[model samples]
Target: MFTQAKLIITAVVLAALIGLGTWWHLSRVHAAEKAVHAHYAVVLSEIREKTAAAVTAFRATETAWRSAIDKEAANGQARIDLARHDAAGARTERDRLLADVARYRTAARTAQHSSAPTAGPTTGDALDLFADLFSRADARAGELAEFADAAHAAGLTCERSFDALSRTKPATVQAPQSNQ
Candidate 1:
């Protein structure tokens, strides 16, 4: 009876120890799983945040790029408009100069045909009038040349600006951060 009693007591204690060890091991496993889940959550949250930031930065860059394009387009258009205006003015001046040249030629031809016979007051007056007409024609020609030069310069400047604008490249988008 005493041996039987000792065996039963030992068996009960062994069962209790087994149950306690299993509970402890299960609790440890549960804690490990919880920690893993928490780490994954943190990593996922970081990834999401980085993605959001990258998207925002990309949008801002796009907006800036668009604005720059718009401004450049406007500037280019303005340059073209100015060049056109200058060209028109040059044309008008050239036409006026041509008309003046025709008038001067006609006047010279008429004067040559109607020269005075003797050196009298009429002859001196005719000479003075011819001199004044020649001077005025020379001044008009100079003005026409200046207008041509200015128009050419303006056209070249506008073309250069257009070429520069075409050559310009937009800024590249930055790569997003690694989620590792």
Candidate 2:
């Protein structure tokens, strides 16, 4: 009977010791898990904040770029308008000069064809045709020159706008020279 009682008491003490050890181990594991979770949460929050900041900065840069392009377009339009107005005014003077050219050609032709003894020629065969051709060619050249000037001004304005928007220098392009 005494030996059985001693064995029972020893068994109870061992069971209590095992329970306490299990409790201690579980508490340590729980603490480690909580520490890891907190560290991950902090890292995740930092990543999210940085991403938001980066997006905002990118949006600002895009807006500024758009504004720059808009400004360049407006300036180009103004330049084109001014060029057109000036060209139109030049056309008024050109019209008057063309009228004077026609009047002088008619008078010269009449004087050459006259057989009058007072003023001028008795014959005008090929010279009259040549004079008419020269007058026509000179008037056509003047018209072409004015058109080229206006077109060149407008083209330059467009090129400047493109260069400004693209943030580059003015690039020159030469036409291929024709052998003819």
Candidate 3:
């Protein structure tokens, strides 16, 4: 004979496992996310360094071009072109990185704050956490899509700019003829 008490007990046990599994999965996801964030931080630092170098190089070339032209006649269109290309590429990369950071921040926040809905067990003491977990997972999925788009666009733009910059000639100014 099926008894109400037995059925209730069975339901509670099932709910407990569901809650535990949800917690475990979410914990694993959080760990993986932390690793991803660490890797991204390193990459972001590298990107910043590369962008700064590109900017410095561009500025130096600009200064040289200005001084050369001001002192004597010099055409440094190639250098100017290259500098423009570098700046544009850096801007694209920085923008993409910012986008990725925004997505990650949103995901982390959602994970930390969101909670799953629950069915009140007969004991009414333990709450269901799986609902919130599901919500967080959905949020992460959305964030991942945005991150992927930014990465793809940034990669394509960087590749194109690098190709263009590589083909450009280093601008040179011949010393003005001196009738000494």
Tell me, by lDDT, which candidate is best.
1
The collision pairs in model 2 are none
Cα lDDT of model 3 by residue, 9-124, tens digit: 99999999999999999999999999989877877776777677777777766676555444322123344445456555755665675566557656655654575544643221
Candidate 1 local lDDT, 50-134, one digit each (tens): 7787777767766765665666667656666776676668667766866776686677667766975545444445655765776
Cα TM-score per model:
0.57, 0.62, 0.35
Task: Please report the candidate that would top TM-score against the real structure.
Answer: 2
lDDT of 2 by residue, 1-180 (tens): 899999998899888999999999999999999998887787777677766776676666666666766776676667667766766676676677667766766777687557455554333545556666766776686677667766776676667656665673233333333223
Clashing pairs in 1: none
lDDT of each: 0.69, 0.68, 0.58
TM-score of 2: 0.62
Q: Compared to the true structure, candidate 1 yields what TM-score?
A: 0.57
Q: Report the lDDT of model 1 for residue 102.
A: 63
Residue 67 Cα positional deviation in candidate 3, in Å, after optimal superposition = 3.3
